[model samples]
Target: MDIVPLLDRIGEPQAAALFGLITGLIFGIAAQRSSFCLRASVVEFAHGRLGSRMAVWLLAFSTAVVWTQMAELSGMMRAEDARMMAVPGSISGAVVGGLLFGAGMVMARGCSGRLLVLAATGNMRSVVSGLVFAVVAQMALQGWLAPVRNWIAGLWITPGGTNFNLLTSLHLPQQSGFVIGLAFALAALWLARKNRVSLRVLFTASGVGFAVAAGWVLTYSLSQVAFDPVQVESATFTGPSANTLMFFLTSSPVLEFDIGLVPGVFLGAFLSAAWGRELKLQGFEGAGSMSRALIGAAFMGMGGMLAGGCAIGAGVTGGSIFVGTAWLALFCMWIGGMATSWLLDQRGAVAQPGLHVPH
Candidate 1:
């Protein structure tokens, strides 16, 4: 789908936004229907639910890996040419940020992507978390907290760094990286086979992976369009969340894919919720829930920026490309999530009468 002529015909910004909208809409629908929440996946695993939803996450991520590689192999898109691949990054930032983001996701009850879907489905808690996540992400990116973020990021930033992944570090062929990614994905599928999985979970996860891969292909095509300054990237919710917020605050006519994608998620979720009769107004349980949400959202926003992406962005999309930072972020996120689950258990035990807290 050569988009150069399309850009020439309908204009670059419109074309990009349209493509983003289509992908985002599909993502939102799949997510809404499948209950695809990374945070939940982690929590369930910690609680011994095993491969049920976790399988969904794995399948989606694996699907993305396969599709993204296909695009690269077919000359439709090159992962190495993406901005995240070109820019210098911090390993410390990825580790620390992922931990923070993971902990926050547990407290907030969802990641930024899940919040967006919930918000569209009339979840007030999600609305608050989504807004806070966007605002804090903006702060970490270039707002009041930017200096702090930069300082921490600079601590581990490597100039002209290579070997951020096993394949690159080992000096192996790129095909080796593809194999590693597929192997992990396959392992996830195998684990998921232990439980009775639903068709909705399978289909939704596959769609999500496809949506992510499509985002890459679409953005790459837009980058090839003449006279347009489209960034070669895929769906990363954290930065895009901030971008969506900024679009409304400023008076610029910059119709970016990010902006279109954000709203597209909401619209798609709204439609799915309506169709499924799942649209219902919900709010925080009390002051405690609200307070937890505030802290969680703040952490997620800052952490996501520091880590370079959120679950979908870095974990699924970036991980699919076999990047070093994405792998570290994913590992640390699991650790952070597990730790938070333990803490939550302790806190719950403490709150109960005649309950003895474990050492």
Candidate 2:
């Protein structure tokens, strides 16, 4: 959709926020209904099964990859200009941050995006954890933790500096993205069918992916037509969560994409849950669970900032575009998640004993 006329009317910031709201709403509903979560997928993998949860994650991820590549091929978006690519990335940060974020996901029983979705569905445990996640994320971004994040991030740089691309590093053709995305889609389909994931689940999971792709394309499209420059980006909760928190705290807050995105996701998730009669007030099973979740949220807040994105942010959003550091981060996340699952899940209620995973 050409947004030039709309840009003239509502201005760039407002337009971006509007788009973010729409993108987030789609993502929230799809994720809420489909239970698209990387943490559960990793746990399933650790348990030696590609079950329904794993299938949902795979479907959402592959669908994002496929659609993103298609958009690039159609000239609707240019992934090369996205911050994940344009800005120099850190190898060390990806490794360390991914490990922390993954382990925290296990402890928290959800990743940042999943936590927000659960919170919207009236999970009090998630609400507390989510708020903590936001505060820590803000700290990591600009507070005392910023120096630490910066130091770690400076430890290792991407091989080719700012213009790095995984596919390019591998000497692959431009069309290879489409080919690779198609392959991912096929594998995801195989997993879905094997796991007997319902059609409804499959469809909603695909919606999540589509929203991610739309975020990239729509934002890029806006940047092309707008009088002022805008960042081309896609869905990610870490920074957005922090920004949203500050938006409410400050008297004269700036209008931006992240500001609208968080509330939009919450509203969308809440609406879907309420409509489906799935909204229920839930709290921590015990003090152990609450403390564990809060600690996990703290880890995720710092780790996500250091790593450059959260699970959905780096794994699905950036990975779809074949960003070098993003893929590395995603790979490390899986390794960390699998390791944590093996250690915690194998203990049979060892990780937060009475803590119940929200459905």
Candidate 3:
């Protein structure tokens, strides 16, 4: 309740920005090294390959759940402290948003995080996707689509209407949710290892999960301190997608950009690319590819808004907390991606020349 002491201890804006930078750096590194992308994973899965991408995603989910639980049990944090848990009706939006985001991500070839990391690595197509995502996200958030979003939000329905985290709705305790999440993470690691994937791949995938969990812990926990009482700590693509666009446009606003997990993710990938010598300025080679990236970015923005998060936001961070909406959003996203892929395949859209795998 009392944040003055906490603020005095950490030094608000500076601490928050620093926290973001560190988290973003780690996320970028993991993403660059592992090529951790939800779009790629879903696409590959649909294409009949049991690749390590999905495993990496699951690992992140499990790690988040376990770490969050540990934090709560140790009195290091509180679940009620997060914004997602405080808004249950948003579950409806999460599902719809996820479905849209999933489809868009598939069309665009990556999610928000992937786009940022890829853009940092000099992938031109990713740069375009990132730009489109940021722009459209802003439009959806406060520009053209705000009214529609608000209207749709007003239509949400649930019995009792109580704010329900996934665990609460399922009649599961916080401890149980943590256990389940950790168990799943361990299982994912085991399965991934059993596949005889290269140690580099294995480490990269697992490390991404750890980085994600650490991001939530650092940001949300830090935000809770008195110095900077952030209402929530989350990792999703939509808000940043919009913020990135705003930052680019209003560069002279002297905008106090809070360095958070997403920025760290971008920095992480930049550093990783630098280390690997993989950084290069690459751009869309085909009109069709550019179109796809634009359309996909729009979809990701709208869908993320509806779903309440993207791969990291809902799929890993929120999902780990067992938010009811996160589960719905995750499945909807998968379905949306699969649906989009199928539609594209039927139209022979995916077979276009220059449409190479990003990872």
Q: Report the number of the highest-TM-score candidate.
A: 2
lDDT (C-alpha, whole model) for all candidates: 0.84, 0.89, 0.72
The candidate 2 region of ten consecutive residues with least summed lDDT is: 350-359
Q: How well does candidate 2 match the true structure in TM-score terms? A: 0.95
Better of 1 and 2 by lDDT: 2
Please provide, for model 2 over 1-359, each residue's C-alpha lDDT reduced to its tens digit, 9 standing for 90 to 100: 67778888888999889989999999999999998899999988887887888878888998899999999989999988897788899999899999999988888999999999999999999999999999999999999899999999999987656837888889999899878877877888888899888899999999999999999998899888877778889999999999999998999988877877788889889999998999999999998889989998998998899889999999999998998888888988888888877776556556567964322
Best by lDDT: 2
After superposition, candidate 3 runs with Cα above 4 Å error: 1-10, 157-162, 251-258, 349-359
Write candidate 1's Cα lDDT for 1-359 as tens digits.
Answer: 77767877889888878887988998999889878889988888787666677888888888888888878878888776777776776788898999999999989989899999999999999999999999999999989999988888778875575425546677988676557657867776686667767767788877888888899899888887648466777777999999989989998857878888999889988998999999999999999999998899998999999888998888888887777888788887888887897798788887886776443
Please give the lDDT score for candidate 3. 0.72
| Candidates in descending lDDT order | 2, 1, 3
* lDDT (Cα, 0-100) at 341 in candidate 2: 76
| Candidate 3 structure quality by residue, lDDT tens digits, 104-151 | 989888888888889888888887788778777778789899887767
Query: Which ranges of candidate 2 are over 4 A from the true structure?
Result: 346-359
